[model samples]
Target: MKENILVIGGTGKTGRKVAHKLSKNGHLVRVGSRSGSPAFDWHKPEYWSLALQGMDKVYITFQPDLAVPGALNAIEALTKQAKNANIKKIVLLSGKGEREAELCEQVIIHSGIDYTIIRASWFNQNFSESFFLEPILEGFVALPQADIKVPYVDTEDISDVAVEALLNDKHNSKIYQLTGSRSLTFKEVINEISETTGRDIAFTPIAISAYTNMMKQQEVPDDFIWLVEYLFTEVLGNPNNSEITNDIEHVLGRKPKDISEYIKETAATGIWNS
Candidate 1:
């Protein structure tokens, strides 16, 4: 059945990809961004109704992260509005290691709407589109851990899964644990990208305190630094997330895109052509 789908955080990494895939497949896509028509701002509840208007399905990707303070309340409020608007289905992009994100998922589970939760691992695009990008470009990637391995899922893969969940009701009421087919340390990931691009990039593993000081020196906002620290100290320290999952293959019927492939494609796009 054809349905109207509104993509919240439509301009973000995964949300943009989800919106594009849905649009190309002929689903009616309404972008819910602060800049979109009938702008939607999660911080401003007034715009919620306008964004939910005329939509039967919603793909909700919270900005910053769902682990941030007050996310649960906002999610509860949004789910209520979705129910009020008669929206029958909802797909949420959540983090795998976040306990707070789990709270938000519970809100959707009991919302009486068809819900799909995509609890995703770290994104492969972090090296190209996020904090790690600049460090890679600078040839000096300083991070907190050298031995910790992560199952980093690509946003493209996540987007594909998200699109499937939204357009097909088969995934309704399912919680998918999405991860890359393999796990790699941050050093290993950087090495792979360096080999792909023929760039001599080096990974400098610093202490938690040292990394914090570096961020302070660069004048990164305190809250953002706190968030990163929380992720490294709390979430990354959790060992359960180190194992890879077949959820992507289970949903998309194929092996998830590998980090090497992602690096090659990103290099071809000139985004990492340093």
Candidate 2:
């Protein structure tokens, strides 16, 4: 069935891919961003209704993440607005191991609308498309996580699952925990990138407190600093985050891309070339 769909944070990592896939599949896709028509801003609730207007389904990718402070309230209010707009289905892109992310999931679960939750592990694009890019370019990546391994899933897989959930009613009311086929520590990840790009990139694992202080010295925003600390200390610190899952293969009917392939593909783009 053809339906109008709105993708909040439509320009972001997973959101962009979701929006693109939906648009390519003959669905009406409205990208909800501050720069989009009827501009949607998470901080500005007033724009939400306008973005929701005439939309039958929504793919939600909250700014920053749902683990940050005030995210629960924002999610609750947005769910209310989505309901009021008579939106039939909602697919939320969520974090895998964060408690606050679960609270936000509850908001959508009880939002009086059919919903699908894609609780995702860390993204492979973090190295090529996000904060890690600059560090990778500089030939030295510093972080607080060393021993912990992450089952970093690809945004392409995430988008595939989200698109499937949006187009299929069978996925409604389902919670999919998506992860890569295997786990890799930060050291192994850097080594993979080094091998792919043939560059001598270094990995430095600092203490959590030391990382926090470095971010402070760099003048990173307090909220961003808090999120970094929370991710390293709370999420990455948990052993459960290292577990690989078959959810991606179940959803897409194929194995998720490995980090090696991701590194090879990303390195070809010259994003990590130093």
Candidate 3:
């Protein structure tokens, strides 16, 4: 049964992959983004109804993060819009360790629409595609939470599970705490990437406060710094965050991609060195 799927933030790391896979699987995909027709912007709730129009299911990847302020309200309003649009299912990509993110998940769980929540660990792409990339490119990375082992999940696996949840009705109301098959600390993963690329990248472990101060010095946005601080202290600091989950295998019937694989493949893309 083919369906019309709207991927909000469709051009993003995980959303784009989900969109591509859905399209490849023959589902009609409408990319709901600021650039798309009937554009979807998080700040503008008015556009959401237009984007939700005519879509059967929606893959939602909230901007910044679910932990940020106003996210709960935005999610609540979006659920209403989705219901009005007659959207059948919604798959939300949420953070694994953040408590505030969990509060946002409550909105979807009770949204009265079929829903699946994927509580994901930190993404592997953070190193290759996002904030960590510049530091990696500089051959020097500095941060806090150096000792905590994070089961950093790949965006590929996250996308795969999200697509499966959307197409299959059995996943409705399921909250999958998605993590990798194993865990590694920031220092360990950086070492792997350095060895993989044969680059002499250095890793420094500082206090969370010190790390935030560094960001402040660099003029990183205050909200972003707050998020970083919250994640490093409140989220990553949680002991349960390091626990490995078989949710990916439980859904996809295979082991989640290891950070090593991400390092090798991402290194191949030269994003790390570039």
Candidate 4:
């Protein structure tokens, strides 16, 4: 049955992909952005009621990381509103190893609504659509840590799982720990990009202070810097995160896209052309 679905961060990377797939599948999709019809803004409580109106299901993608201050409160308030609006199902896009994100998950779980939690590792799109894009274009990627290995899941896979959970009842009330089929260090990823694009890409491992200083020099926003530091120090530092998962195959009935494939496809987009 086709249902009206609200994608909270519909303009964002994964959310946009999910919305596209759902729309293509013939479901009613209302993008919930500040500029959208019945505009929705997480920081603006007054904007939510109109967005949630007549929506039976919602895909919640919290902006600026749920680890930030006031995220839990915002999520709680949104879930409450979703419940009162008679929204029957919710799918949350969450981060791995984020305590505050888990708190938000708790709110959804106890909201008496069918909820599916997609706790994902770092996104491969970080290299394509985020901070790493500039470095890749320049052929030199510099970062704070060298020893950590991240199981970076592709946003395409994330969107697939999210679409399944939202449009089907089979995935209700489950936490999907999604990751890439393999773990890759920063150097490994850079080397893969170099091979795929036939360019000399280099990974420079620098001190945390140096990385922070470089970001400040580049005029990176304070919130983005905080999120970067949190990911590097706290999330990446955890050894348990380096393992792969079968959740992608379990959900989509196929192996998740490999990093090389991601690199090749993204490289063809000419982002790394120099």
Candidate 5:
């Protein structure tokens, strides 16, 4: 059956991909962004009903990290609005090792609405599409938690699972943990990118405190800096986060994209060199 789906954070990493696939599958997709029709904004609760109105399902990716302050309240409020709008199912993109993100998941679980929780490891796109890209372009990368091995999942795989969950009832009330087939450290990631791009990129391991201090010196936002520190200390520091999971394969019936494939594809885009 064709469905009307609202994709919150629709232009974001996984959200845009999910929306595209849904549209290709012949679903009515209303992208939820500040600039999108009905104009969905996380900070604006009054406008949520406009976004949710007449949507059969919603794919939600919280702006910033769900670990940030007031996220739980915002999620709770959104769930309430979803219920009011008669939204049937919601697929939430959540962090795998984040305790606070888990709390936000609970709100959806008890919302009396059908839901699928995608608990994902760190994303492979961080090195290419996010903050790490700038440093890689500059030929130097410095970060905390360099010793931790992260089984970074690709956003494409994430979107695939999300689309499946949204379109099928079998995934209702399911919680899937998504990770790559293998784990890699910061140095390993940098090495692969450097090799793939044929660029001489350097990696430096620094203390978490020192790293946050550097962000402060750069005048990065305090809340963002706080969330980064929390992720380094809380999420990456947890050893269980490194365990490779077959959740993506289980859901999509194929192995998740390996980091090498991501590196190679990204290198071809000339993003790192640019």
Candidate 6:
């Protein structure tokens, strides 16, 4: 059954992929962004109803992250609005192992509407598509994390799961913990990229305080700096976050993409060639 769907943050990493898949499958997709038609902005609740109006389902990928402050309230408000708009289902992109993210998930779980939570580990695209891209291009990656291995799930896998959840009722009320088949440390990640791209990229481990100070010196936004500190110290610091899950295989009947494959594919794009 084809339905009208709204993809919040539709231009973002996972949301863009999700919107593309849904649209290709003959579902009507409304991209919810500050620049989208009807203009949905998280900081501005008044814009939400216009975006939700007439949509049968919504795919929510919150900006920054749900782990940040004020995210819980925003999510709760949006869930209520979506429910009130009579949207039948919602698929939320969430973070794994973050307590605050879990609290936001609870909001949707009890929102009186059918919902699916795709709880994910770090995205592999952070190197190719996000803030880390510049560092990768500069031939050096500096961060506060070291010795810790991350499962680094691919956004393509995330998109596949999100599309499945939106189109199928079986996924409703389900929480899928998504991760790569194996864990890799930052050093390993850099080495793979260096080998794949034939570029001499280097990884530098720094203290959390030093990382924070550097970002502050660079005049990064305070909220973003806070989020970075929170993730480095709170999320990555936990050993349990490194556990791999078969939820991707369970949902799509296929193994998740590995980091090596991701490196090869991304390297071919020449994004890291610098």
Model 3, 1-274: lDDT tens digits are 9999999889999999999999999999999899999888999998889899889999999988999998999999999999989989999999987889999899888888999999999999999778998999998999887888999999999999999999998999999999988899999999999999999999999888888888999999999998888888999989999999999999999999988998889889877777
Separate clash counts for every candidate: 0, 0, 0, 0, 0, 0
- The predicted structure with the larger lDDT, 4 or 5, is 5
TM-score, predicted candidate 1 vs. hidden true structure: 0.97
Supply the global lDDT for candidate 6. 0.93
**Cα error of candidate 3 at position 151, Å:** 0.7
Give lDDT: candidate 1, residue 163.
94
Q: After superposition, how far is residue 181 of candidate 5 from its true place, in Å?
A: 0.2
- Please give the lDDT score for candidate 4: 0.90
Off by over 4 Å in 4: none
Better of 3 and 5 by TM-score: 5
Give TM per candidate: 0.97, 0.98, 0.98, 0.97, 0.99, 0.98
Query: Could you give me the TM-score of model 4 versus the true structure?
Result: 0.97
Indicate the residue-level lDDT of 208 in model 6.
91
In model 6, the Cα lDDT at residue 53 comes to: 99
| Candidate 3 runs further than 4 Å off | none
Candidate 5 local Cα displacement, residue 233, angstroms:
0.7
lDDT of 5 by residue, 40-146 (tens): 99999999999999999999999898999999999999999999999999999999989999999999999999999999999999988888889999999998888
Indicate which candidate wins on TM-score.
5
Better of 2 and 6 by lDDT: 6
Q: Which pairs of residues collide in candidate 5?
A: none
- The Cα error of candidate 3 at residue 189, in Å, is 0.7
Displacement of residue 13 (Cα, Å) in model 2 is 0.5
lDDT of each: 0.91, 0.91, 0.92, 0.90, 0.95, 0.93
- What is the overall TM-score of model 5 with all chains considered together? 0.99
C-alpha RMSD between model 1 and the true structure: 1.1
Ten contiguous residues minimizing lDDT sum, candidate 3: 265-274
Q: Clashes in model 3: which pairs?
A: none
